[model samples]
Target: MEIGEDYRDAVLPQSRWEKRKFVRCDFTEADLRGLVTQGCTFEECDFTRTDLGESKHDSTAFRSCVFDRTVLAEITWTGCSLLGSSFVDCRLRKIKVRETDFTLVSLGRADLRQCELSGLRFREANLVEANLSGARLRDTDLRAARLLGTDLSETDLRGAKLDADALVQAKFTGARVDLDTAIAFAAAHGLIISS
Candidate 1:
């Protein structure tokens, strides 16, 4: 379904509705805070600069949605499906995403500092230029995910399976790593250190 032509300045309310279906709608610069949007379906919608703070989104499906500059601080997402979704330049600090399916999602230039994302499967996802400093990533599968200019400083990657190609342009300064991986990283990146 094609979206409305003047959907940028449109303001939709979700105070009464629990499970709202937003299909092909544009929510640019909209305020959607303190709402319970459980099990909502948002397909092909543009959520640019929208505020979704303190919202309860459990088991929500957001496919092919563009979340450019979206303010998603202090949101709790549990059992959500975000396949093929793009969140460019979004603020996502202090968010907890438990048991979420984020396959093939792109989160470029997003600030996810100090977020908790344990055991999340992000296969083939693009996390380019994303700030993931001090985040929890224990046993997470980051296979085939892009790390172009991504800041992973102080991130926990214990037992996290990641391919070597995914470490391209990933900054892990002061991060915790094993001995074997540290040697391999220094060798692969061509560094000259003292003993």
Candidate 2:
């Protein structure tokens, strides 16, 4: 389906975007805060440099979207599916994502402090230089994902697996882990501790 640019001009008000499909549209630098969209579909759209901060979405699906340099701070997402999305240089602080599927997403240089992500699938994601301080990552898969220069202080990796080269710059202050696992994991990363 071909999407028109004029549709972007119309007001997409909050609390009224359920099961609507907006494909191949340019939403760059758009102010979409506080917009509550449930079960909506966004395909092949460009949300680069967009301000989607503090938005609430439920069961929304975004496929093959380009969100490069987007500001997605303080967004609350639930049961959403974001497959094949690329988020380079994106900032995602204080985000609440629950029951979401982020398959094959590229989240390089993303700031993810105090974020809560539960039952999420981050398969094949590139999280380079991503800061995840005080973040909750339950049931998150980081297989084959790159995590160079990533800061993860106080992050909960209880049921999460560390991907290849995914802990280069991960910090673990105020974090909890099993002693054997902690010592083994940290030691493998050349982490030095004082007596």
Cα lDDT of all candidates, in order? 0.79, 0.74
**Shift of residue 56 alpha carbon in model 1, Å:** 1.3
Tens-place lDDT digits, model 2, residues 89-160:
777877788888888887777777778864588877777777777788755776666677777778877767
**Candidate 1: residue 143 lDDT (0-100):** 81
Q: How close is candidate 1 to the true structure, as a TM-score?
A: 0.82
* TM-scores for every predicted model: 0.82, 0.80
Which number leads on TM-score?
Answer: 1
